[model samples]
Target: MLQTLKLLLPALIPSWRFFDWIAPSPRIEIKVNNDWQEFRPRPDHVSFPTMMKRMVWNPYVNENLFLASCAERLVDNPADQHSYEQILNRILADINDQKVTSLQFRLAFIHREGNALKKDIRYVSKIHDVSGAQA
Candidate 1:
């Protein structure tokens, strides 16, 4: 497995910055207690690209592939109302594990228009109450 190799020989792999030039910069956000926070990986605190590249030994191995895939669907058709309850449920469980309440999920994209890059919020999930059954 890739995880096993990461532990045995960590120095062989290159950093995320090496492939940043070829990735699309996408913003992923999560809401806890009604507060929106950007989701960034720990330690290095690196935020991964929306569209991922398949590399055998990439440093961005810990990227949220689930979120990235879901985000792509949202970007492809912003108006499509898809039930991401499964994903939301997992996130809710994580929040509960952390002893937090209130939950929301959002994904944004940067659209290029001429020389300007515009931020477009493509997806925003409803605020779900963690106390009761998932909405």
Candidate 2:
């Protein structure tokens, strides 16, 4: 019994090392016209009622989280075709304006430096046409 308890102790207790090597996460940005913008910009603020409602039901928020995961996967493996296509399709769907012909996207690593946040561009995709065509 003593040996069994000792063997299970490490598994039962959480380790601090889990938080020690946190790395920067990736963000997806799309360039329209000449300006770059977040693919899914977070709302500046949410009312208490809306926040409470989101706790139970929030498809948009869930989808955005999935997209962020895809961006992270893309950053880890630039050649990941599924993630690349998923991001491209999602961005294309969001751009409703027919006048917008082409757009570019890039992956940025966002990290904190002391009190300020910094962004480092890691990959910039070729400009793709909005009409379900890759350029």
Candidate 3:
């Protein structure tokens, strides 16, 4: 998936800033593939990075979040898997019917002392702009 993304990123993204975890308020990462390329657009085969138990994501993260995140990115941006994960999760919330579930941004309250899972949510609607977060 990472290799595919690098190949397809340039066309789908009008302009993008790479994201990083260090060195700045919002870190920017460089694309692994060379600068300009076109996406092949194969939603069926795109794969996600394995979720780690000690990762920063919520406690109840599951395959739904993983797969939906991919589908969600196809609609918005098909190139960046990281961006797809973040944006796709939010949009996936909206995809569910209104009567069944409300679009509400899910939150986890981790205590400073223990970092335990205090809450679990399946929906999120308060997010106004998920512009920069690339997973």
Q: Name the candidate that leads on lDDT.
A: 2
Clashing pairs in 2: none
lDDT of each: 0.63, 0.83, 0.36
Q: Which structure is stronger by lDDT: 1 or 2?
A: 2
Q: Provide the global lDDT of candidate 3 against the true structure.
A: 0.36
Ranking by TM-score: 2, 1, 3
The lDDT-based order of candidates, best leading, equals: 2, 1, 3
Residue 47 miss distance in model 1 (angstroms): 17
lDDT of 3 by residue, 3-112 (tens): 89997988787565544322111111111122211112224542355344326664334443454444344434435557545643544444333232222232222222
lDDT per residue as tens, model 2, 1-135: 998999799888957586476578778899988899888888898899998999999999888878888888888898988888888888887886545778889989889999999999988888886655433
lDDT by residue (32-131, candidate 1, tens digit) is 6667777644455434552244344454444466566667766677654553654565566556556455677887776677788887777787777666
Task: Report the lDDT of model 1 for residue 100.
Answer: 59
Q: Please provide the root mean square deviation of candidate 3 (C-alpha atoms, Å).
A: 17.1
